[model samples]
Target: MNKILRSFTLFTALSAASVGVHAGNYWTASAQDGWIDGYVEATLLLSGNLDASGIDTDVDDGTVTLRGKVETDIDKALAQELALGVDGVIGVENMLTVFSPGDNDDAAKQRKLTDEKVATVVKTRLMVAPNVTSADIDVNSTKGVVVLQGKVKNDAEKQRATEIATKASDVEKVVNKLSVSE
Candidate 1:
């Protein structure tokens, strides 16, 4: 039983999905190889692809959790497969809105000078841009780095979004999470 418990704990720790970036105490995501965050960020950006079907993904360490809704079961299956294909993703969870309730008012906001209003203003700036689409993306203001995700038509669109995101006054760095369609 002790061995089983240990294994299960390891699985739980290693297999975290994007839904909850960490099991508890979400304080700046202080985990090693923080590169996992980058991989997760990249996956979310790519998911915006027209081929990606717009499944909002979350990740902690290497554990990726997905949310939002897709059009079909095939879409869900494809989403899971895509995430698994990524090099650093350790796990994938699709808690997406196969049939979702309206957007949840509850969200975590940490270490940001910009409030939701400012963030929205920034997002609106990007959304209005003809080239870059912000759907199926997660925008969090943690420590001044504006992380972007979603699918793009090509590298040009991805690069465009990164430039737009950096336009914000306090945005220190823009992490590109856009993915390309193969």
Candidate 2:
């Protein structure tokens, strides 16, 4: 019984550390969303039941929006299930399109992959940008076109986000829909 308790404690500590939480430190809203995003991505990638390469996850207020393509409807359902299983996720918006090989050729698959990559890169760049508050920003991509949505501090931040997104590889255009908060 003592050994089991010790192991459980260790596991809890590791889990907390994995999510960037330390003792006596609370998770901010943005931190929680970041953790949820990473958790959902990891969960889908590790599921082994789905391809996950074309998937992109965005978390806002505990709701996860899953975008991109999957080979089958089952894969789409599985991705949503896996995302909903994450501890902080309250809802899942499955925007995953079912890829029909007969309808889509290799070029289509490549375009989907490129879109996923663009979204990921843009989101990552926004998150790391010092002047950008990326927590409220949501990134989406379709066929190399990137869309930025949500709120930012000011026009500068919004423009900075657009510039950052436009710099991502394979981004043909950036449609900025970010509203400036008063």
Candidate 3:
């Protein structure tokens, strides 16, 4: 009875070891190269054919995860298709969401109008500033955030431009990327 019990225990251990080996081999086979490679390839593939501005991608092992909002259902499906086409991508987790048309349209339009107003106000302020040169400055506003880009003669001019932008109505933030010329 002891001999039979010993044999049964050994057989059970062997079976468990074989199962582990098979599982390891299966995982290795599925993950052909690396997750990074899969991510890059999928990104390039999607970017080539799509606008790709709002789309984001993540890869784990052989599975690809796509996230972000697309304009339409067609765009969402296209993004998934592009991701799946990549080599070594065994599965695709398509988590892309479509942009809501009715609600988003009104909000986007309002935001754009607000941004335009902010930019115009900032521009007018810069023009009125005695020491600042408004000709070379480029003003762009998005969602109350103003981006001032161009060249300035000195640090004072950069500071003045930022101040002007920050004072505009509804201006939430100001990004001054103006280069001061020596």
Best by TM-score: 2
lDDT for each residue of candidate 3 in 70-96, tens digit (9 for 90 to 100) = 776555655665555444567888887
Residue range 116-162, candidate 1, lDDT tens digits: 32244346556556777677555654556777766777888778878
Which pairs of residues clash in candidate 2, taking residues 3 or more apart in a chain or in different chains? none
TM-score per candidate: 0.37, 0.45, 0.42
The lDDT for every candidate, in the order shown, is 0.57, 0.79, 0.70
For candidate 1, give the lDDT. Answer: 0.57
RMSD (CA, Å), each prediction:
18.3, 12.0, 16.8
lDDT ranking, best first: 2, 3, 1
Which lDDT tens digits does candidate 2 get at residues 46-111? 554468999999999899999998887556766776676566789999999887533334576556
Clashes of 3: 0
Instruction: Score residue 43 of candidate 3 by CA lDDT.
Output: 46
